[model samples]
Target: MPTQPKVIFFDVNETLLDLQPVKESVANALNGRKELVPLWFTTLLQYSLVATVGDRYADFGDIGAATLRMVAEKNHITLSQEAAEAALKPIRSLPPHPEVPAALRRLQRAGFRLFTLTNGGSAALQDQIGHAGLEPYFENLLSVESIGKFKPHRDVYNWAADEVGASPKDCLLVAAHGWDVAGAAWAGMQTAFIARPGQALYPLAGPTTYTCEDLSSLADRLVD
Candidate 1:
């Protein structure tokens, strides 16, 4: 059997929590538009990449606000600051996917230490984790805010490993986002791809260590 990881770092957002409701909310808020939410999310990610490539950084909240404004303007919807902020509020209260709690419980019971790393602000991440009843499972909740950079950045993954006192080789990163897994792998951590449908794989050079349909499957691999 392969040796088990000493620490497992989970990605927030679509990995553990479902963002569909927030997407739908944004769609409705934009007057029944179906693709506005996706567009906004894509824009948010694009800007983060820009920041990274340009050696600039911005908080997730600021990126979110700017993305929302751009989306609204593109769709010819005039939104005030209050409206933009309100539209993005659902991010903090997104419910965990149905498979999350049980899987996390199983992982905890199996003696695997857990932690989280997200691009979301610390306060927002705390609210979402608390709302999903997942706060108890994590040994630590880490955010890119602390490192002043976003994921796919080597520093964030290095910081997470250091915080948990785990060597990169002994840490496993679990994430729905391919880019995150790619980054972790590049940082010398093992990676498990939570293959949520419709998400694409990152064009990284090395293969991921494992792929699963959801957290439950991932937990089974970790504990078995």
Candidate 2:
């Protein structure tokens, strides 16, 4: 049997929060080209990795605005810096997935220590958690900004383990991004992949310890 984790780390963004509002906002900024939102998001993530690889640390929000501008420029849409920032403003107040609150309650009741780890900056993370009323759910809101790297960087996971005083192997990372699952696994942690729409596991990575359509299902598996 798989060992039960003593600590559970959740990735923020699309893992716990629904990003549709932000997507809609970006779509509007793209001149109603809703189809471009996904591409813009992809570019945002891509540049985040670029920043990490180059040893340059920028807040996640700044990366988002810059990538939004890049996407707009590529598609021949003129986007001002202020407009790009405005489009990403919804990220601070995203609603949780319908199943998130109840699922978190179950996990907490089951005696698992929970924390949120994200690539967002400290202030942005605080605003997000507070605005979503999720502050009470986690013991801490950890950001990669502390270590000057992004997720999927081995150092970030190791640093997170140190922050919570837990051994990497004794913790489980639950995330909607396959790359995140892979990173945690590589960093010597267990992983649960939340198979959100349009998301899939990276075939090149090792198998995830658990795969569920949503957090409620994950709770069903974790809570007795």
Stretches of candidate 1 off by over 4 Å are none
TM-score of each: 0.94, 0.98
Give residue 40's error in model 1 in angstroms.
1.4
> For candidate 1, what is the TM-score?
0.94
**Error of model 1, residue 99, in angstroms:** 1.0
lDDT of 1 by residue, 150-201 (tens): 8888888999999888899899999998889999999999998898877877
Which residue segments of model 2 deviate by more than 4 Å? none
Which 10 residues in a row give candidate 1 its minimum summed lDDT?
A: 197-206
Q: List the residue pairs that clash in candidate 2.
A: none
Per-residue C-alpha lDDT of model 2 across residues 1-224, encoded as one tens digit per residue = 57999999999899999999999999999999999998988898899999999999999999999999999999999999999999999999999999999899889889999999899999989988898788887888999999999999999999999999999999999999999999999999999999999998999888998899999999998886
Residue 224 shift from truth in candidate 1, angstroms: 1.3
Error of 2 at 35 (Å): 1.6
Strongest candidate by TM-score: 2
